[model samples]
Target chain A: MAYSDKVLDHYNNPRNVGNLDKKDPNVGTGLVGAPECGDVMKLQIKVNPETGVIEDAKFKTFGCGSAIASSSLATEMLKGKTVDEALQIKNTLIVNELSLPPVKIHCSVLAEDAIKAAITDYKAKSATPATAQTA
Target chain B: MDNHHNCWHCGTPDAGSIFCRYCNSLQAPVPNYFEFFGMPLKLSVDLARLQKQFYSLSGLLHPDRYTRRSEQEKRYSLEASSILNDAYRVLRDPIQRAEYVLKEAGFDIGEQRSKDVPPELLEEVFELNMALDELRMGDDEVLPQLDESRKKFLDILVEMDAGLEQQFQKHDAQEGDEARRAVLAEIRLTLNRRRYIKNLVNEVDKLLTARNA
Candidate 1:
């Protein structure tokens, strides 16, 4: 299928395609997959503990162009936003930005799921410092 | 929903019939995978019996037998042969049969790129991908990690299969739509997880093969 120019742009030059220090106290990691298509996406965010603002974001995805573009755009939009603000970024918005087709809509959903998973992991870690290391 | 078919030659209504007895012509709208073979809607099918039926039907539907017959009979033979082939192709395998049944029941078995990632495997999946990337980059140090991932993924698959068997038994025993729907949902989730693990194993195997080569 022909991808939109925006999707092609992101696919060719994906922003923040890497990993964060998952073990860091301030970093939250989100890993997600679509078992049907075998698409695995890893999105991570580093937040400033004192300010509760996202300081950095990165992603690594093994899937299609839409998934790659979605995660790339996700990291780009996530940086500098608060965790709550990042949570508010909908899959619909990603679809709009990427001009994703109906079939590729699930890629955006995976991106959204990845973001939520990362934030949840971060919250869980912050809530229990004692067990964080063991966890 | 409509299973009835009329023979093109004689217009005889053939309900659950492979061929029209009136005109001896092939009919359209073949029965579903299960019904075509006169088998019960169950997960575990007897392969030997299914195979025997397939061969018997194949022999009966062989186009060679219709060589001296009318054009209509030859066409019917070809159609019936195609239907028989499709039924055997899907029903012979346990997973394919389960998926076919689910599809027939109006359940979407999320296609590839399905966004339904099993919640528990997120973290492990992330790390596994990282290990895969390292292996692709010719990093020998991650070999052990890849092996560990393979083992873990295989364990999940085994667990999923066991869960599927139990769900299948429950589905067969249940008498109501509500109970059967619940069982179907469980089977869907287990099948989804199994697919992911299978993909992961294939990924690991690819890397290992390249390394050995």
Candidate 2:
């Protein structure tokens, strides 16, 4: 099957791919996998803790070409958005943007799943109580 | 799929004779994987027998054998070689073989999202989910609880797996189709439970990984 030119371009020249300090307080990291292809993707966003804005975003994907493109595009969409805005990036939008085929749509879905997972991780960590006041 | 060919070793028909099964020349391609590997379709398969069959067949069908052949013949050889490898991969793994059998039998357990994970797995699934949730919450108390649950569930699965083997032996030896169908249903249920428990264990592993992550 002939892939989209954008997919081939991204596959040949992937951008902004790296890992974040996943344990850092200001980073929201999403890790996800696809059942059909057994692919893994990790997307991370460094958010401004006080303002809730994404200062930077990066991804590392291990799968077929479509998986790489989906993650690459996901990071592109996330950069510079507020953490809340980045979480709202939907799988459907990613799929349409990439014009992914039906069988390859899960690549985009995995990307979306990673974004949600990362944001949820950030929220849960933020909600944890810090040092308690002495009695 | 028509990978059948004439054996050049002695010009005997390749369809029915891999390595002649007569003169042992290592130059024939049997029909499907099971026949090629000389294995019966059974729940309790002998791994040793299966492995022996594969090496023997690979000796005949592997792509390296066609290096001196014409381009057309070499392409056919390569296709057959990959299929041979893929067949072994599908058959040797119990879970993969079971899924292939289920597909051939026209049954889909449904996608993972169909989370209508059978009611039988509810309690175990629920407990697994809770363990995952707690682990996500960074509760150090979760792994021990999951470890205990995993052990109990695995013990049950092992017992069931043994029972199915015995039942398979009996069913294969028995008479009527009615009796065989009944045994098959029982086997299916047992396999289904096994699948669910495996998914549960995977969930627990994911939880542990996330905690460390």
The per-prediction i-RMS, to one decimal, reads 2.8, 7.9
| lDDT (Cα, 0-100) at B17 in candidate 1 | 61
**Top of the candidates by lDDT:** 1
Q: What's the C-alpha lDDT at position A100 in model 1?
A: 95
Candidate 2 structure quality by residue, lDDT tens digits, A50-101: 8988888888776789989988988889888887788688989988888899
Total backbone collisions for each predicted model: 3, 0
**Model 1 misplaced regions, further than 4 Å:** A1-9, A129-135, B1-16, B19-29, B111-115
State candidate 2's DockQ: 0.03
For model 2, the docking class works out as: incorrect
Worst 10-residue lDDT window for candidate 2 chain A reads A126-135
True contacts kept of 2: 0.00
Candidate 1 per-residue lDDT over residues B1-213, each given as its tens digit:
344666667777753466677765555535677777877777778999999999998898898998998887788788778888988999987788888888988898865444456566866887788888887887889988889888988888888888887887888888887888888877887777777788888988987887899
| Model 1 alpha-carbon miss at residue A127, Å | 3.9
In candidate 2, list every pair of residues with a backbone clash. none
Task: Spell out the clash pairs found in candidate 1.
Answer: A36-B112, A37-B112, A37-B113
- For candidate 1, report its TM-score: 0.85
